[model samples]
Target: MWGDRGRGGYVVHPYRGYGSRREAFLMGRVFRQTALSDRIPRYGVLRDLADVLRRIIRWGLPEVSVEVSLGENVTTVTTDHDGYFDVHLLLEHPLPDDTSWHHAELHVVMPQAEPVHSFAEIYIPPPSADLLVISDIDDTVMYTGVANKLRMLHRLFVKQAHQRMAFPGVAALYQALHAGPSGNAKRPILYVSRGPWSIYEMLEEFFQLNRIPVGPILFLREWGISWRKPWPRRAEDHKYDVILHMLSMRDDLPCVLIGDSGQHDPEVYARIVHEFPERVRAVYIRRIERKPDRERAIDRLRDEIRHTGCDLMLAEDSLAMAEHAFEQRLISERGLEKVRRESSR
Candidate 1:
């Protein structure tokens, strides 16, 4: 689920199910775009009620649906009786970076006299020679969930401020990537996420508080329960219009896709490789949870990697990937060495 906060809506975090599946829950925040009513509430103070409503629209709650994409295929799931739903993304052919983007749309239906409907798109741009690592802040690179399953579900919907912790070494790794000399280049290290748009200030505060590096942050504005949020505007109708739009802007650099194994990265990257065989250099997947038989799964995906000729890795830390990138001369020695030092510490 990926989204933002506004008067009328919010986007949810973009989710990916285990392997080739869409995440179980579609996350979004709902808010009234209209100004607060001047009338006082029957019980609570008018101002207090208005404030609460603002938070709800900004970061509290929103409704949505699940949409998953693998290669050219797409699957959609709706909320159940409990207003929850789950769908898996099937990866028959892993996409490569050159493939440009893997486009998927999720439909959200708000229960109303005239239902509100919305759509979401997952766009993965081709890698830049300088490399761009677009990632989600939640499960992809964090271990805030105490008991894994229980906490993960809670954080998935609630946006618990305290539970928002970074994965081991991720901060240091990102810092090294951005702080080192090579990182000062003109190309951008974009952070496009599905987290609340209103929370942008909060996220900036968190990044500074946590000493995380700065980058371009793009957030989706959450539409109503039924209203669909379309992908970034593009003139072309190529399924991967958004990503292509982003990639097309930068013609000089190849790209490297980084994400977790939880959701659409595998499928998205697979299609990217297929679409733009020349633009992507590698795909680095953080080995998060919800996986089945880790050893067997890695072995199988490894074979698939051999077939695709893409550098696929399951790393415990971004530093490990940085090390590989350094070895391949993808990153400058100073940057690689900095990551190594930070990771080792």
Candidate 2:
């Protein structure tokens, strides 16, 4: 009697996820549609404001049971107080090698509410995958002005996906990395962001609109804030945990970590290198700020972590990063040329 379908309509927002042959994880939310509609309100200042507000001001259908199935695996999970469910799926056998993408079925089950079904596409990297790429979304890939709260908020609320810009040559560089050294490895690129889940759809549209290579997963954070704890927890802590968990899952694989010098990415990525030096092939920090103090700080960090065997590069542009990757044989010559061409245009 008390669901979105009862009053109007409810939706299961299943996020794109990634997995291995043995296990997979998918996260999603259940929300009741607003009085208007689920789609974003169109092109006016007031409409944009309403669009941003509607995303953040969510009414989560909490504590409801959900059924998640992938391949031969099937499980049930209950949404948290915020209506977010993390589906930890265990497969009975390895996923078939014929395909890389798997669509998982999500069924919502709650008392008095009609059972709603949704599909989540999960990417399982093929055996040909040589390396994994984990990247930051905000300042590293796009100009979100994440270092400044006011600018960040303004950009987030006021801009449409087309209005949101990607850093120059990013799409080309990412496509190169996706192609890998031999130019066809089709390596898995997993993006991890410090942003909230509310902005997921916007980010997806931004990637599509920018011609950026879409990652199989966009791991985002959940800020469970309250009046008593208004500040919430440290976001870097969440990032640290997420990276470590991804690293732990595939022991044989090596990954390249990409992030920006802004905020705590330098420190967080350095921590990852220090802990799992063997697992990390390289760490690239995009130079978003030109402050001397920040430059000195990153320089010092680079020197300190040199002994870990993975070099940290402070890239001036996407081309610089692509060049370094080419030299390392992490990307092919054609990939480097692509970035160069894109950067020029």
Among these predictions, the greatest lDDT belongs to: 2
| Tens-digit lDDT track of model 1 for 1-345 | 232332244333333221112221123222224345546453445544454445444333224454555556666665543233445444455555553334445444454523333443333332433555455454555443433656654454444333367665666666555443465542334554444344444455455556665444443333233226333233222323435544565555566666666655565665666777677777777767645675356546545655556677777676878887666556667777666676676
Against the hidden true structure, what lDDT does model 1 obtain?
0.50
lDDT of each: 0.50, 0.83
TM-score of 2: 0.93
Model 2 lDDT at residue 262: 85
Residue ranges of candidate 2 with Cα displaced over 4 Å:
1-8, 37-42, 225-233
Model number with the top TM-score: 2
The window of 10 residues in a row where model 2 has the poorest summed lDDT is 1-10
* Estimated TM-score for each candidate: 0.54, 0.93
Tens digits of per-residue lDDT, candidate 2, 1-107, equal: 01232133678889998888888889999877665454644456666677666676677889888898887788999988988888888888667788888988999
